[model samples]
Target: MSMDDQVFKRQGFGTDVDLVPPFGLLLVDFVNGFADPGVFGGGNITSAIASSQPLLDYARRCGWPVAHSRIVFADDGADHNIFSRKVPGMLTLREDSHASAIVPELAPIAGELVVRKTVPSAFFGTTLAAWLTQRSVSTLLVAGCVTSGCVRASVVDAMSLGFTPLVVADCVGDRAIAPHDASLFDMQQKYAMVMDRQAALELCDQAAPGN
Candidate 1:
């Protein structure tokens, strides 16, 4: 382990959370804008988006309840918030805007919830927690864009609301590499279980109900 990791471990952090049954996957803000570098995408975001496809497919094959979130504001910008004010461009991701649409690669199929939020946390003002609760989802597998921003926000909320969140590292990206790596490390140390795309899903496969 790195010297920093040894220190963190001595401080009684970075405990590994077991990936248990009844898993659900939440893909946060993998929208078109975040996928296009010119718009909001860059760094490893493209590969992250590409990696999530298999995760989604695996979730489908395993019959796990899946949900996707998009940052959608009202057409007239009536739903503006601190998030929008900070990044005013977020307000442009209105109801029917192409930029706000979840990319076609990870599109939510029928029977999956499509969460729309005006802020960072998907479970903040949305029915995400309730919806996942209704589906009996005890552990949530997370994948999406801008790891330091929306992904971290949603992971924290997921943990606070009594759900075990497993962040699929390779499947979550950011416009900035440093923040992306830092968020993964922080989330690993504190809020959630962090694993690479293959490792996380493989654990899920091993621990999945009836396996």
Candidate 2:
């Protein structure tokens, strides 16, 4: 076995998590800013977005509760936080800025929740957890950009909130490949169930209603 495998095995990490019913979809920061390489985009983010289109379609077909998150700051910058201070460019993602708008392909339809936040975790200072819980979402299928950042943060918080997080590996991306791969492994070993889009879909199909 590889050293990494040996370590995880000895530590009893990377346990399998069964796919549960009442699944919800959380699309984080799949906005225009993260899609443009000249801005906060790079690596496989564009490819990830493309891959997520079908996943979104599947979620809609399954009638899963879908929620999307965007990093939007106040237009006047009055609501800027430490996150914006750390990455000054984040302040540009104002309420009406095109950069903070969800990309068209996976745009949320009527009835889907849209969460606006300035921090990494969607649940932080937001009603995302309560929203998911209200819909009886036991398992959350996660797809988004910057696997190392907002996606990871949301997955960790989802687990902490007693929700099973199933991260679609190919449907989440980072500006750098190393962090993307590393974050996926870490999440699989600790916070969430990490799988590719096809495998996730198969599991979803196998899950019975009210399971």
Candidate 3:
């Protein structure tokens, strides 16, 4: 076995969590800025977004509750936080800024929840948790950008709030491959169930009505 696998096995980590429905999908920070390599994009982010297109379609077909998050600060920088301090460019993602807007291809439709926040975790200081809870969402499928940052943070918070977070591996990316892989491993080992798009779709198919 791989060294990491051996270690995790001995330490009793990486347990398989069952995928339960009513499912919800949380897409974090797949905004214009993150999709532009000249801005905050690089690595496999573009491909991740491409792969997520089908996953998003699958979720909609299954009639799952969907939520998306964008990092939007006040136009006057009044809502600046430690996140922006570390990356001052975050302040540029103001309300009217195109950089903070969700990519048109994956944009939210009428009933999808679009959450605006200045923090990494979507659930922190946001109505995402209650929104999911009210919809009886027992499992949350996550797909988005910067796997090492906002995606990781959101997954942990989703678990903390008692939702089974199924992180679609191929649908999440980071600016750097190393951090992206590391974060995926860490999340799989601890907080969430990490699997690729096909596996996730299979689970959803199996859980569908009359299946």
Candidate 4:
């Protein structure tokens, strides 16, 4: 099936519920490679990263258990997986590679968790689900690059793991506008609560005091 077909099929599942859950943040794959146009980066991803900065600051101030994911492979590509097969250059995101490093603006703090993975979904091979559950994090505020790829995969996994994934629309982007818009629509209709960054921030702020 084509990308559009699969996306539409996913959206047919439907997503409608109240946004009443404890919140945390998950910033996915906002690294140098995704930020540079010459590499994997392009389109509105740059704007998304900028939009995520304030959201990150707010998440920190609210004492949320923030987590970030980087798509890294072993230095020797020994850990390459199906993900790398699609984007072979992903194998270059080694431990010491600058392209793998989280953008300076959204870098994780001392206590925040940094999850490194060779897969799309952050929860697939990581302890992200357990970590959030342990911290009583019921609502996951998601932001990242390439909305149609890692972000969408993570959203599905988040739902499957019983977390309310609120995808910040303006805080996630793709190399092109079409996929970004389409993925946001699919996520809103299916796996997650998709909203603008400002709306998401306000929701988190309101939930913070009680959390």
Error of 1 at 5 (Å): 1.2
Regions of model 4 farther than 4 Å from truth: 1-15
Task: In angstroms, give how far residue 130 of model 4 lies from its true place.
Answer: 0.7
Q: Which 10 consecutive residues of model 2 have the lowest summed lDDT?
A: 202-211
Q: For residues 1-211, write the lDDT of model 1, one tens digit per residue.
A: 9998998899988898777889999999999999998888999999999999999999999899999999999999898889999999998897799999999999889999999999989999999999999999989999998899999999999999999999999999999999999999999999999989888877887886577
RMSD of 4: 3.8
Misplaced by over 4 Å in model 1 are: none
TM-score against truth, every candidate: 0.97, 0.97, 0.98, 0.91
Give the better candidate number (2 or 4) by lDDT: 2
**Cα lDDT computed for each candidate against the true fold:** 0.93, 0.94, 0.94, 0.88
Higher-TM-score candidate among 1 and 4?
1
Error of 4 at 122 (Å): 0.8
What value of lDDT does candidate 4 attain over all alpha carbons? 0.88
Per-residue lDDT over 1-211 for candidate 4, one digit per residue giving the tens place of the 0 to 100 score? 7777577667665546667656889999999999999999999999999999999998888788899999888988898777789889888888789999999999888999999889888889899999999999888999998899999999999999999999999899899999999888888777899889888777766765655
Worst 10 residues of 1 by lDDT: 201-210
Model 2 spans with C-alpha error above 4 angstroms: none
Model 4 / residue 64 / CA error / Å: 0.5
Candidate 3 residue pairs in clash (backbone atoms < 3 Å) = none
